[model samples]
Target chain A: MTAVPDPTAELPVAIAARPAPGLGALFLTCLKIGLLSFGGGLSGWLYQEFVARNRWISDEDFASSLAISQMLPGANVVNLVICMGDELRGLAGSVACVLGFLVGPFFAVIALSALFDSLPDVTMLEAASNGVAYAALGLLLVICLKGVQRATKFPPGLVVIAAVAIAVGLLKLPLIPLVLVIAPVSVALAWRRS
Target chain B: MRDDDLVTLIAVFVPFSLLSIGGGSAIIAGIQHESVAVHGWISSREFIDLFAISRAAPGPGTMLATLIGWKVAGWWGALAASLALFLPSSLLCYGVIKVSNAHKAKRWHKAMREGLAPVGVGLVIAGVISIFRLSGGGLVAAAIAVASAAILTWMPRFPTLGILVLGAATTSALYSLGD
Candidate 1:
């Protein structure tokens, strides 16, 4: 696409102004996220690392990336990394991020599976892992709360949130359709509020 | 690794990659069906083992595909399967992001971000419930999760690794006692 130069187009420039982290740092960060997020809540940990720690992007950007990732086809966390990585450093950034994210688990899962196969007792081990999950949920909860806080000052946003939770979480609706229906309403509400 | 089995891995996972809406969990059932009932790469029992292992291991739950490939055809198979599963959707997501970036200056960008933020939060909560249920972590797990969340919120500086370690210790001790 040809670049349409617009004088008012300042938001992109400001967001893009944040110093790009080196590929190695990007890789390391993702590696930490991948290996450490054993019980889930990878996205929350991702928020903690990227937006919260490094200040790479605004909280709104992170949440929006997450929402976009959810609508797309792929693992939500991986898709999230892709979006954030792209924002940070273009294509190469995304490559480094996704590889760093996946490479550790590739080896760890194989090795752990081998270990599990050989070992006689994993009951305690399983319990421990579940414990890790229980705690990891805490991390996710914090991030979710933060996202919820950022989302709504108006009641409409709350309605959107409740609708999503009920339709998907309670009634077990498919996400894409729900998103297609809910997203427009949300965008409209946000448009009005903004 | 047999060439044919590798081909099968690619064919099976590529579609599922695109089908993985929301997250990797969306395709788990289809993956299981293909591997176990259709191709017979592994039995039903073995699929469960791999699922359990994927959960226990770090990274995306879709690493279940990686594990399946590892079992079916070895390292090359694992690589092929994972690439097939993740690459297509990654490309699509990347394109969408690029477009979104191009429109970064638009007024709607702010509105879209704000609007989707709540939806994202809701999906996140839904995901939390599902992941927690999958673990069958029970009441003790529930209590620990809430307590841990409280502690983390209160003390943002607290190291994550320490909390996780504490969780393991606490839960394992309780489990051993109950047993």
Candidate 2:
């Protein structure tokens, strides 16, 4: 594809030396992602905002953060926002992001149940929800495939990817034990090669 | 919310919060076990509905905690449960990020990054598989997934919200036509 001119390029260097996103910006962005992302694509939405759109972090940085978030405990997306937020504005940013992200969804879920209860048995609601869910899966598939594409460039990386997919996806092993078994070995192998 | 109910919420969610390595999906079965069977806080049917609503709503699947809390003790239950589920892991994530940022040039950091990348990829693919299964075996769902993915991959600029809306509309139309 032809190179699109970056809009930031037009700005004077002195003026362009902007600060990192403040807590408010982080909060709003997280809130937007939280409210808009309908189905199971919270991570994908996060990637879009932080990496793709805002250019807050490099793709590799985002990927590493993502890896760490997934490997650690809690909701993957919530952990992601925390990592990103902390990077941007320390503890306060982390707090803001989680609060902004969850605040909307908190009320939305409650409202949704109430709405469903109040409605006169709309037949199409479930169908639409399923579609949205599938589409969200599609969003996830796009990101996952891209991750695979990036990983497969190295043979060892490809092997690791395959091993994890089978162990977690197919075998359906308990994650904590699986990670305990796999993570250290993978890190050690990478350590040796490096 | 009753004082004891909040205590029970904290008791059940805190350990699961820490034990939820590889994200909240890992602890879902445990939550179900505690809520539906052990605690009798919500019935099995309500659990399923809340799960669906959580998926369809936004944010994390763990927001099922919020819904459960709402059912048990109104809005305060939602807040309490949400905090119990999210706060501990987030604190852990905050510490990890700080360490990683501080030691940018460390060899072990590099190793961790490299090793974790493929693992993350695998976990995401595993997520795709799980969502597919949860969606049930449907040709339409499969097709929407493939089509949306293709659009995202090739165009790279298509609005995700548009795709979601389109998917919902198409699926709604199709299902509404049946029976």
Candidate 3:
């Protein structure tokens, strides 16, 4: 599984049609991003590697993938990887990218679990972790604000943000029902505006 | 790991994955309900700790599944839980992307994207509030969060890990001094 994708083999016409990078290169790049990124800035790491450094995808393509990722479910970073992988190298590439991205953290979290078990008395470690968690909230708040700015081009977009915050955040309604109710309304409004 | 436990992991996470519509934040309450109350895999306090650790760890915040599974049933459980939560949603996404690509310029696609953008933002804000509450909503925690947000807004290029380390060191020093 760790073998490099053959650079010279006759790739299937489907894969050959796209300006695809080797699966090995895609996996390694994902692995590097996974291992190096910390404290919840995975997207920033992804943007740097895929868009800025390597130019594997253009800025617009990255933004579009990010939009799709956000619009769908699960983790935005994971979805983003899936979209990038699909675009670059199809289904196998998508699987490889996800595995590459997740493998490091999978092992790291297991190691952390072991460490937590051993350091039962490390009150300071707990405190530091709390600090980091709270700080990550700060990062999240900025991202939310930026997202709001992006969404507000249409007038009803602000309304959707407020309604969702109230319904899901304050009212504590469960999300699936809330989304089922609000999503259609927001989409209709967007359709009208369009 | 017990076979029953593996089955339970699958049953709990698969539905949660489908419900994770906006992102990981959307399903936090559901996961908490299942893991802490319904299944009794971990205590509520332990749930919070795992949440914090998962948040602070690299990779997706959804790795909380891996941690929860690891805690409950070792490596096999971790494997089962992560796949259950991740696989279905990803496959759905792949399918949707394929369909959406065919209709790339359709008005409905635009509407869907526009409609969901704000909801995605709202979910993230809710996440911030939840984390703030989890951190005990202390004046120091609030101050750190607000200050960090302000600084990051001012300097969009600031290194996030640097800010994380700064927050940790500053809080740790305060606790040491208090003690």
For lDDT, the strongest prediction is 1
Expressed as tens digits, the lDDT of each residue in A1-194 for candidate 2 is: 89886554343212322357888899999888888888778888887677655767555456667778887888888888888788778889889989999998988899988987788976678788788888888887876776677665667777877787888888898766786688787788779888
Between prediction 2 and prediction 3, the one with superior DockQ is: 2
Q: Which lDDT tens digits does candidate 2 get at residues B18-98? A: 988877767889999999999999999989888878877877888898888888888888888988998888888888788
Q: Give a tens-digit lDDT track for model 3, residues B45-132.
A: 9999888777657788888998898878899999998999899989988987888767868888777766666666666666566656
- lDDT value for model 1: 0.85
Best by DockQ: 2
**How well does chain A score by TM in each candidate?**
0.86, 0.83, 0.64
Model 3 agreement with the true structure over A70-133: per-residue lDDT tens digits: 6677888889899888878888889889989998888877777677768758789767866766
Task: Write candidate 1's Cα lDDT for B1-179 as tens digits.
Answer: 68998999999999999999878878899999999999989999989998988988889889999999999999998899999999999999999888887988898988998888888888888777876777787787788888887876666556777778888999899889989
Tell me which residue pairs clash in candidate 3.
none
Identify the runs in model 1 with alpha carbons over 4 angstroms from their true place: A1-18
The stretch of ten residues in a row with the least summed lDDT in candidate 2 chain A is A9-18
TM-score of chain B for predicted candidate 1 = 0.94
Model 2's lDDT to the true fold? Answer: 0.80
A best-first ranking of the candidates according to their lDDT comes to 1, 2, 3
